[model samples]
Target: MPGKDAHNDTPRRVLDANFPDLALPAAVAARLPALVHCRRLASGRSLFVPGHRPTAFYAVAAGEIEARFTGLDGTVSVIEHVGAPRLFGLAAFAAGQPTEYEAVARGASEVLVIGREAYVLLMDEMPGFARALLAEFARRHDGTLRLLQAARHQSAAERFVLALAQLARERGRAAGDGWLEVTATQAELARLAHLSRQTANELLASAEAAGRVRRGRGHWLWRGDRE
Candidate 1:
């Protein structure tokens, strides 16, 4: 659904709600250009690795990046996906800790790299900037924790339904064919729902038979009807 893309910070709807006036001073946006350098990262490239220290936190200019962690058993779990104007390497900026995960460009992406030192400089000079940064980081941390908990607790069927409802509210459009153009594969749906591929397939099969979704080429289109 086109409505699925409805986000506070998505390129379509720009909001001044960014960096709260509570923490980010109005003038701090001016300092961004001086502290940040633009960079183009190609698809499949690794921006940083586990155990590496970051010099700067990146603000997405365009395109998306995937954050993943490799388990000791060699399983790779996609931890998070970030789109434009979102912050990456925020933990490093906050605590000077080595990165715990790997960051890879999901596609050709542009980012503004702002050195931690420069950020610290600005934070010292601008209390608003420091407050905003810390507050944002805390919120993201909480969101990630909640997502992980839901994945761990929710079943394949429940997760699928929850995901569909969210997508319906966010991206679903008013197409007349009793279908919405949700161009996600079963595999991708599995990842998003934090379920295994086979389990995800089973859930979708039941839903399809029950008229909850319809499969199209390289995509899974959700139908609003539920049995």
Candidate 2:
């Protein structure tokens, strides 16, 4: 079976198809030094929180970021896991709204922070670059909606299977014998699947009994044959 480290090796083909060769324009890239900056985050550090005014656009340069929404009752739901070379937090910039989710680093990570003024300037002067990013935004938005719908309509076991497959695609890598692996705590999996922790645990145990999965330290193995 693969391990936690293998999760970082997964190819984001779904997003990558639309986001192929994404890059800032030369002029915009050059101006980034003045209008944008980079930061390194230790694992568990928050990049932004709900209700924060959008000051800048963010892109992950390395490592993973977990996006989560917290309800009025303080219940937290995992929205998605974003990996390196991907943009996030664009909703606030595009709509001029306060952020609705908290984005946290999943591990040691680096991010590009582009200031609002520069972001607008680039959009005006670099329409191609802007269009590319908009496509990514659209794709992410649709995916999020689908995940939410799945959470609302699917059974607990079905939701867990769906979430497991998604995470595997986004963050896992293949092991021998048609297995995939990812490094995620059961709590994180529960949040991602929108299931209670006990429900996730029970479902996973059933999966294991059915020979569809195997649990490991800080990670889980999924049988590709099953999903």
Best candidate (score: TM-score): 2
- lDDT, candidate 2, 122-152, per-residue tens: 6776547577877777877887887888889
Which run of 10 residues does model 1 get worst, by summed lDDT? 7-16
Displacement of the residue 72 alpha carbon in candidate 2, Å? 3.2
What would the per-residue lDDT of candidate 1 be over residues 1-227, giving only the tens digit for each residue?
22322321232111133453544344554454455566789998888989988877876767877787888998776666666667778897567789999988978987667786557666776666666777877877775675566778966677767555544533355656677766456775677667889988888788888877877787566776646
Alpha-carbon error at 188 in model 2, in Å?
0.9
Best lDDT goes to which candidate?
2
Candidate 1 residue 145 C-alpha distance from true site, Å: 1.8
Q: Please give the RMSD to the true structure for each candidate, in Å.
A: 7.1, 6.7
Off by over 4 Å in 1: 1-30, 125-127, 151-153, 158-185, 201-227
Residue 169 accuracy (lDDT) in model 1: 36
Sequence-dependent TM-score of model 1: 0.67
lDDT for position 152 in model 1? 83
